[model samples]
Target: MAERRTIVSGSTFEEQIGYARAVVDGDHVHVSGTTGFDYATMTIADDVVDQAEQCLRNITAALTEAGCTAADVVRVRYYFPDRADFEPCWPSFRRYFAGARPAATMLVCGLADPRMKLEIEVDARRPG
Candidate 1:
């Protein structure tokens, strides 16, 4: 049987949220929606672009912990509270995703927390 692993970053909220950083099933890794809040500082950045960048950072950390890298990402979903915020952060997003360029979706949505302007979710695969 394939192993099931739960990725946790030692954050209490992770348990509260009832989700893991990533779950590995066979060759696939499914990462949950990650926010821009810095888990270390427990704070969210003020700027939308900065928050977006931080969201990617959090996603990267989660992926790394799951024995994967940005290059392995096959799909990405980005949630933004405001569509206008996307323009300013497009460059940063492109810079980070230049190599992977996973199938992506960007949308404007009301997030769980008011302080959270952006959230990122990803799916990755380990090469056979």
Candidate 2:
């Protein structure tokens, strides 16, 4: 059987959340929903676009830590507090996802934190 591994991004909520930031099972890497909050500062950015960019940055950091890259991402889930936030940031999202056109979903929902405007989760794969 393939070994299972947990990838922690050093978030303080790991204990409460009861999950790692990512997990590696053989060639597959699954990343958790990442928010705009800077884990180090425990603060969320104000602007929606800035928040989206930061979320992707966090996702990238997690992917890298898991021995994967954005190019390897096969799926992505985006959560927005409002649909209006999506329009201004489409360009930024396009740039980040330029090479890897992963299957994606975007939804509007309430987040745990009121300051958060967007969150993203990614799934990546490496060949066996």
Candidate 3:
């Protein structure tokens, strides 16, 4: 059997919610939906665009730890409470996913925190 490992971002939510920020199973890495909070300070930007940028920062960290990069991502999921917030985030999203062109989905839905404007999740595969 392949080894399965967990990646932690030291978010209180992980301990409270009982979930890892990401998990690695062999060559595959599954990153949990990450919000805009900067884990270091536990602070989130008020603007959705800023939050979107932070979301990518958080996701990138997990991907790097998993021996991957944004280019290695194969699938992505974006969550936002407001559909209007989506269009404004395109530039931020494109900054990471432009040429990589990973499969993607965006959904409008409620989030755990009212302050959270966006969440991003990704799946990546390490090349053989």
Q: Name the candidate that leads on lDDT.
A: 3
Error of 3 at 10 (Å): 0.8
lDDT of 3: 0.94
Superposition TM-score, candidate 3 onto the true structure: 0.97
In candidate 1, the residue pairs with backbone N, CA or C atoms under 3 Å apart (3 or more residues apart, or in different chains) clash, namely: none
lDDT per residue as tens, model 1, 35-105: 88888888888898888888888888888877888889999888888888878888988887778989999
RMSD of 2: 1.2
What is the Cα-based TM-score of model 2?
A: 0.93
Candidate 2 lDDT, tens digit per residue, 70-111?
Answer: 889999888888889988989988888878999999999998
Q: How many clashing pairs does model 1 include?
A: 0
In model 2, residue pairs whose N, Cα or C atoms come closer than 3 Å (at least 3 residues apart or on different chains), thus clashing, are none
- Candidate 3 C-alpha error for residue 13, in Å: 0.4
Candidate 3 residue lDDT tens string, 1-128: 99799999989999999999999999999999999999999999999999999889999999999989999999999998999999999999998998689999999999999999999999999778
Candidate topping TM-score: 3
Q: What is the lDDT of residue 98 in candidate 1?
A: 73
Candidate 1 vs candidate 3: which has greater lDDT?
A: 3
